[model samples]
Target: METTQHRVVATGHADWAGTSTQYQYIGPDQNKHAERVSWKGHAEAVRRFITDLLKQKPPALTDLSHLAAVGHRVVHGGDYTTAIQITPDVRSRIEQLRTLAPLHNPPSLETLAAAEAELPNLPHIATFDTAFHSTLPPKAYTYPIPMKWTRDWGIRRFGFHGLSHAYCSNQATNMLDRPRDELRLVICHLGHGCSAAAVQGGRCLDTTMGFTPLDGLMMATRSGSIDPGILEYVQNNHGLSAEQVGHSLNHDSGLLGVSEISGDLRQLEEAANDGHELAQLAIGIYVHRIRQAIGALTVTLGGIDALIFTAGVGENSSGIRRLICSDLECLGLELDTEANTACQPDADIATKSSRGRILVIATREDLTMVREIQAIIDLSSQGPGGVPQVTVSKSNDKLPGISNS
Candidate 1:
């Protein structure tokens, strides 16, 4: 029997001017191939990329018909608690979430539409980055705002990067040789988009990102948490409208805003090494905010069993990790300076004498999405008695592990 497995992974990014699509596939011989293209339109580019990939007749991926199923990494799923098949209604619901995730959902929808049109016969699944944080308690999710806004606007902390958090949590448990239910962890996902998560018993206790991706730790170009009063103050003083302020915060702020230079951390670090005051200040602010979040989330977990660093910066930048873990002896977390500077992925950089484990794990959100899609498919295929049944309701009352409040 042939044991080789075939799969395709595709991604579409909507940049300032246009869109780009990248696709990868594994052939029957177990060799891998990839291709990328940049074009003007998002949906059209995606369609063209897939069409071109098929024309090349990749070993295992001859065409869209060869795929068993398509799994999409949806940035926001709103109220959905699990991965679901992308039906017409589901697509519409995803479209409705655009306003909440202006930078993410639109590009996702464009790619999704292109894929559906190109491969109508294949089953498509939407695995949400927000779904894993659905386990957050009310205290963690609720904003201390007016009752009218809370009740009428559905405004609350909906954490982002949940897929990365979940993946890191699972990997951390495995690395620690402990059952996930018994471990409490603090996961720092640092990348272009950054956030922290406190996970207890495989469930999210709290996370840094709240309501929107813009509300978390400072990111590459996006400003992290900022005072709402600052917005109003700037509007009154600078004659900037609400929309213009939002644009600046989301695009022109963060490291770029503070450094008055490039947003790339590598660039900032180089400039800082040369005694650039603002560059050094930008790096300091970034490290300071991350360390602060770690302390807060450690308290949220009551104590931490393991501290993990994942994602791009977390996995690669040992200097950044060292900076964030500095002066943490009080929390029983110590980094082995030698191991950290080695820049090895999936390694324990904690000192032998350190009480708490400091680990660096490479995050695989794509694997998480694939597992979720497979789980949904497996559940649907089970016999009537094989899977437990539950009543479905429109009200939030039926959600598990969450209070109606």
Candidate 2:
């Protein structure tokens, strides 16, 4: 086996199963890269993801000892993760925050531990989804909750999807060739979960999601931005327990609850096609809330120069994009009817004639993790900020720290 040196293995949970994307840049033979293996996870999805990576293509090129570091997508870093790095102390702190982000942090910690136990000698880095929004203005992050709850419990709004938002906004700027400081934009990241952000001069001015992922616009299941009084009312009158209310709000509400149907957008769309009244109601509520958030972000940014649509729903669903953008003509946003209808994923789905640019950029947080890993590697080699470029090695199909079910 040819001994390969460095590579980036980026993993993500799209359908509740982890999939690793390997990127290796060999010097002269870099152009002759191999086809990527997107392994499917069946029983133990996380374990299967790793098991398949090694089986599909053994790491013939890189040695385990030379593999520098592994970078992870660590969501909800709270106040700890401002930048990206790999250290035992950071991992411990991220584990401590599992209570804050019940859905995201704990699983990420599991993946981290798995990686660590498997490759104890190699470094593992964690890049936060909440870090970029760390630049949030106080007015945007502070909630109207009691001071004690916020100060003691860390209960202020810590926006999610900062990694995607930052990547999309920066990519938008680069593509537009505009300086980051001058561009004021509103980015809508709609997926199974949804959030809208107001970015001014590359910093988060305001966002829709507060404190928890549950805050923000209506999602596939989440009830975004609900009145706190509703929970109390449900508990007192309806005789529902706190956990039941939480479950309903987190898993039963939104499109699923409204339509009384499937949580998947495709199902909801099909129901709407069949002229189901509740489906229309569910979609209507979803789009209406999205527009509402856009309107509010307009005030936050004064006036946005560009509008960005990203994530699963934002990048893939043109109908939702059309409905959301149609009403924003007053804000100098108009989608070209033909182009909007014809656009696809990973493409710049924007209108040509619109005064304010509207773009559909695919969010690549996995690639962002690769970059962060390389940066840390460089920092280790050439002191702080000395290296011009981050070095990434190619992995020859080394297995992840996952068990096969």
Candidate 3:
């Protein structure tokens, strides 16, 4: 998130594992505050941090009474389409879904408990990463698996990076001065975990990710889509168990496995510059997958209007963007070398004659969460009649309660 003492905001910025806590600082001059603490330890940390900060002269919050509400970012909302206030049943359901996002939701649950204890009077809202993708139609979300599995197991494409995709896609609309529904956009979120989403008319048509976050793009450590037969073959031939296979796929694969070096792309790029073949291959695969995904998404949208890139690699890696956009001219996209090389995000970096826009947008999940939280709060405060009542399903797996503080 943010630097502990400096308040440089890194809220809603998640690592591969969701263990950090970032929130509104109970301090004056609070620009952005972040900490990586979790569980009972995380809860205790929040209580201590808040108590100590509020103890300052003329206190930042004038005690807890000045606080409005608490908002949390969840990584995998399976069914919920929007932000919801936390309740006991809701908290329990979130806990149950931990098996799906073991790395993230556990810490989020801990942080939630901690926040609840520390701020008992406040309403805590859960904003989901999967919330924005609830618009995926059946064809896009459905797996070609058995119908029984689909009906009983809730096995469908549950795309993620919703906050980032929602933020960037809307930003694309704003930058182009067009209404969202009027444009066909492909938003690529390239980070520790990557996914590409197809958004049209402010609705997600399809996304690369599926039942789990691990299903889509090649990430820093996780392998993207692969032949499931490989797992069976490894088990049937080798002595590795299913767990071992899963572990390797999730942790030992992707860039790290291919490059046989660091998972960080910067390191891979350096190695590639030094004539490392595998490093070159890793970069090649990464770019190819992105290009392929963009083409498919463009087709899904009927045509391309803008290809927006956001998140870590998308926002900063000019070379990666250039390589991915190089031969994509067939899709009516063209990268401007000069503009791309020195481009700062929230700007277009496409050639003037390119039929589709090439944009780099710095995603702000924190701001997305804020807007959603504020919307819920505004709805709730409109007296009893203004509050919207909706049912929350404890059905199957769902969002991880990642603490963005």
Cα lDDT of model 1 by residue, 1-405, tens digit: 011121322322223232443434333354545555444454554454455434544422343434445567677788888989889999999999887777777767766766677667767788888899999999999999997887898888889888889999888888889888889899999987789999999999999988878898998888999999999999999999989998898788899999998788889989999999999999999999999999999999889888999988899888899899999998999889998999577889999999899999998776677667667653343212232211110111011110000
The list of candidate 3 runs beyond 4 A from truth reads 1-41, 48-60, 378-405
The alpha-carbon lDDT assigned to residue 94 of candidate 3 equals 78
Over 251-338, each residue of candidate 2 has an lDDT whose tens digit, in order, gives: 7999999999977788898899899999999999999999999989988889978989998888888888988887688998888877
Ranking by TM-score: 1, 3, 2
Instruction: Using TM-score as the measure, name the better of candidate 1 and candidate 2.
Output: 1
- Scored against the true structure, residue 73 in model 1 reaches a CA lDDT of 69
lDDT of 2: 0.69
Query: Looking at model 3, which ten-residue stretch has the lowest summed lDDT?
Result: 389-398
Clashes by residue pair, model 2: 4-61, 4-62, 6-393, 6-394, 7-393, 7-394, 59-396, 157-211
Can you write out model 3's per-residue Cα lDDT over 1-405, one digit (the tens) per residue? Answer: 111122222212222233454333323444444455443245455555566445644344344544456777677767888999989988887787776765556767777777788778778889888889899999988899999999998888889889889998778888999977699999999987899998999899999988888787888888999999988899999989978987888778899999999789999999999999999999999999888899889999999999999988999999999999988889999889999999998899999999999999988776677677767753332212232211111111222332233
Give the alpha-carbon lDDT of every model. Answer: 0.74, 0.69, 0.75
Candidate 1: deviation at residue 38, Å? 6.8
